[model samples]
Target: MPLDPGTPAEAPTRTAELKVRGLTKSFGRAAPVFAGISFEVPHGASVALVGANGTGKSTLLRCCLGLIPADSGEVELLGQQTGALGQGARRRLRARTGMVAQSHNLVPRLSVLSNVQHGLLGSGAGPRYWSHALAPRRAREAAMAALEEVGMADLALRRADGLSGGQSQRVAIARALVHAPRFLIADEPTASLDPAAGEEVMALFFRLVRSEGVTVVFTSHNISHALGYGDRVLGLAGGRLAIDADAAALSERDLGALYG
Candidate 1:
């Protein structure tokens, strides 16, 4: 379908899908980072965007999330054209999306529950008036439930800064889910964790996809993880999409080319 410029919130179609068509981006007069980048993530699918460092994987994600404007092309989330929306409309759309980054992006001093509750801020249900006080009972309850999903509910009272790297990543995952977003974007979510921890986190992501039907688009440099966990794998090289294929069908040689 051609991308529509209006809000999809009122559209009768399912509001849990993402589609990009001819997406192009560039930093300056240089050639575009990606051109004619097109893909569709159906509801509840888990896809990986794989590439070497500096291949514009992160940039593509940021552009999809409206963090940066695309020089041209279409980004349709659910059914709305994201690139054509105003700030208010974009913010409304973002409330339905969740993102996890390698850095965790937590406030060090806050308790895990508090950090998770911040996810509700975008939805206007957060305790923004009393910044120093605890989140309201209902918000805390929801945050705790989200933490439980990531197996971090037991550590909800701990300061975010005190947690181990794996635990912190779990907390970040919980924060992302607290809003009950329809789409999740994770950028190198397990980059700082050990092998076991990475596996655990990826398993949790699979569980979410199966149980909650959340659509996930994540970037990863780990070929094994991409093959093991992703339904589809997209390869970016030299600032463009070089390959798009089923993860189960790709050979090691194909991945080697992406890295080389």
Candidate 2:
């Protein structure tokens, strides 16, 4: 089904944090994952990408962040045209962004503090940023602050593997926030957790992001989350953008069509 590519009425006046125009991607010998997809996310707006499984939500996020090259079209992030950046510049641009995924992506043997400190590695890599003991006092303090925001500071010294699923996600959120990214991208961030834990993590995550005024684009299979947490919702289906509408204007019934 074809859907309008328009944004919220106020979106056009605000500076766009992200803009995708006619973005397309495909793997060798396969149909396009999504073709001619387009949208704009106003600065500080929260967007939810939702679709049924295999709809390429994760791949689209990767393309938007320039983690993977697009087959065609434009992706502008932070007002910079991604296709125009060289490798070094692209890396530098990506440093200003944070990412969270379904998997916690923590180092099992590392202390929670150390894992959070690694978030600083994006700005620059060095021994001092890799371990809690090696990190400078300032970095350590910042990591703790991030952990405090997520209610994970008490587990600073615990090993990553020692935490429960919910605790691990809290630490993951801290790691993502430690660098104070201007934009955050999360792919199914709470998909692995039980409902109660997912609810807590989502609440904490959005509270922290809102307080910091960070723009967010996260994918989720949960329709309730898509509508409740996002300012706008984008839906992908049948190798195209099937829905783009204000989250407030949509109901679960409206979104259910995308699943078919």
Candidate 3:
């Protein structure tokens, strides 16, 4: 059985954080996307999950987030077993975590403030209503604070569809941060941006990790960028965790083997 967050002697010092053990996912009876993958991300650490396309990086993330069922494994979020959680339990679990995918899934017609306010809808504060009349003051304050953190507060009244790709991505990031999640998982956050934009986004992500003490796990294909941004790099190859090491400790040859 997976452990729960408590003062148990066996629990890690920071038990209220993310943990994955023996996680495996498969489409059918064939080989798994990943088998026996295990890793622990302590609170307030930034970890980069790196691998080539089709290596199951996104699959692993989806499984971890309970978006898809894992073939066999255990996932503990904040010390609770998430693999076996029911819908209600999963919903509550997700409330404490945030995700930013490559695609900024924003409502095109909605204003930036409206889009950011949607992040608070899952908190069960109340029923959903029209964006104009439903001025959730606390939620708006939090959303604006998050936007300020990402330097997008000035565009809060603008339509999401009118923003540039980078701006939209920043809004997405702001939405994720508005909830103050204990864990933030970003899947290829910079994949759609130019090099400079990617670096700016990455820098903002790291700044959040450092300033807010939030645990961050992000997926990236650019090895150099991953190395530059991540404290630790987890390399997935052939549906398995092939390499796990400090970014500074890895060499070009090591990265080559992991990719090849």
Tens-place lDDT digits, model 3, residues 219-246? 9888776788777889999878888899
The TM-scores, one per candidate, come to 0.89, 0.94, 0.90
Model 1 steric clash pairs: none
**Top candidate when judged by lDDT against the true structure:** 2
lDDT of 2 at 176: 91
- Give, for candidate 1, the lowest lDDT window spanning 10 residues: 126-135
What digit string (tens of lDDT, one per residue) describes model 1 on residues 124-165? 664551232555677878888998888888888888899998
- Which sections of candidate 1 miss by over 4 Å? 1-16, 126-132
Off-target runs (Cα >4 Å) in candidate 2 are: 1-12
lDDT of every predicted structure (CA atoms): 0.84, 0.92, 0.83
In candidate 2, residue 204 scores what lDDT? 89
lDDT of 2 by residue, 103-192 (tens): 999999999999999888988767788889888899999999989888888989999999999999999999999888999999999999
Worst 10 residues of 2 by lDDT: 2-11
Ranking by lDDT: 2, 1, 3
Clashing pairs in 2: none
